[model samples]
Target: MDQTTLTRPEAETTTAAKPVILTGDRTTGPLHIGHYAGSLKNRLALQDTHTQFLLLADTQALTDNAHDIGKVRRNVLEVACDYLAVGIDPAKTTICLQSHLPALAELSMLYLNFVTVARLERNPTIKDEIRARGFGRDIPAGFLCYPAAQAADITAFKATVVPVGEDQAPLIEQCNEIARRVNAAAGREVLPEAQALIPEAGRLPGIDGRAKMSKSGGNAIPLSASEDEISRAVRAMFTDPEHLRVEQPGRVEGNVVFAYLDAFDAAKEDVAELKDHYRRGGLGDTVLKRRLEDILQALLAPIRARRAEVASDPAQVHRIISEGTQAAREVTEATKREVMDALGLFRL
Candidate 1:
């Protein structure tokens, strides 16, 4: 916890009076287009209006990826590269490493006492994730207690705003519950409750038509995917199977291609017209896929190029992370001290 701040032009500093926002990605893998459509796009806008802190949740990634610590370690930089490539300016948003923040871990340990294992098990977000991972009776302790950990991450920064998917609303609720209990114990608001800011775009479906686009599921198109990779993913996308002929009417309700179009295509009217044509028949899946592929390639080419350029300078990336982590350390430490003092912990 060295307090190291990278020297920057005075003009680059953001106002400290803005509302604090905490949002981040688990460093399990590189971010994908789904991330862009869902949270990243909102983050880009919020950084200008709020004090944003982006955490590389390597500590949380260990809940499932403990077996492959190397993967988590390696992707910390990869995720950071993706963030920069996607236009998350470090000056506007503090991008910090989660494992580097000792205060977060300390707060998590303290907050755990305020919540019960039954309540944690009842968390919809945690339950769904457990089912999806098939953890059953073998759920990892870290994974089970992640709601508390998330509460720590949120309250440690006193983040009033957190951008997350709709499915993650319960976790925010759980975090606020912990915050309230701690405040009640302290006889004052030692930690601020957070609100979940779910994106309008919601969750993006995977190419295979899964409800979620995830790297572990092997259905995601990474932001750094090559043109050929994007094309291949689009081509393999799940569409209406019964709409075999171009002349036959098709269904767009569950079509993954249309889902992606809704998420990424800027021309809403054009997408609507395509959807109409798709539903009425005379439009082929290949045509829709081709259009989606073109849009994706155009969208990702610049990001891929930028990611490559940024990644080429590892020292600069490391410095950005180090500086951000240092700044975040100071914030978390101050909050931890406040909580400890409120709880009448021995300081000497």
Candidate 2:
């Protein structure tokens, strides 16, 4: 791939004062604490201040889940419920279904010309997913070109800020590359380059002490998990393996329990005391798990309750998604028209 394609267009050198923020997740499963720490909380904060467009990326989910449409369909509502339960006010945040925007596909097709196959293959984020999924040679074409589609998604909204985790920084870079190339080719700034806003909390470790929590890995505590489920997940969380006994000194490093505490527990002094005790050979996993469970239950009680309330009225949930998707479609249409005009391509 030519590196020049990734450079920012000379005509578009400055950013918008109040940037439009776009961030979302694949609708493969219900969201979890990882989602909360990584992007969901940021979305909540940005919704009131910036023009936010949250996407339920059903189409992207299909790249890996084409064989399981039912799972994806079920999760669309589950994820939406999780969003509402987590206080993403739909009035402030436009939550849209990715598949509803046909223009995104058109844009992706056009953007593909700007990005090379070699460049897409070199994307660290995509490579990580490919390895994680064990796709190897059997990787789907759609999965390979996901970045192009993502660029389209971001540029369709003219997103200036994309809140993401550290791992997704490359994805933002790829999106900007497409934006730069598209605008430069058009001889005008047709798309705005997006910057990644990585969260301070970064990746939350899974209950199994994995580098990152994932729904498919069965290591995630879903945002909508019941109190009992949360408790069970907490109890099973991976702690210091060498500290087999309560009296044995434990290692705090790579301990999933401690990781969760650092991420969620507000009792800084208490958590520090507990960690000290564990390090010095006193605290047990049971005690630490209990503390985590209490803190998590308290934090998630209201979210779970709200999710229950939202899930009760399926029609209302559908209505919200329908309205949001329609509104998003209009935005996508306008963006598509501009892109076509810039390319001097006739719209059918």
Best by TM-score: 1
TM-score of each: 0.95, 0.92
Badly placed stretches (over 4 Å) of model 1 are 1-15
Give candidate 2 regions above 4 Å deviation: 1-18, 346-348
Clashes of 2: 0
Model 2 Cα lDDT, one tens digit per residue, 32-136: 989988888788888768877789999999999999989989999999889888988776677789988899999999999999999999999999999989998
Candidate 2 has which clashing residue pairs, if any? none
Worst 10 residues of 1 by lDDT: 1-10
Best by lDDT: 1
**TM-score of decoy 1:** 0.95
Number of colliding residue pairs in model 1: 0
Angstrom error of the Cα, residue 272, model 2: value is: 3.7
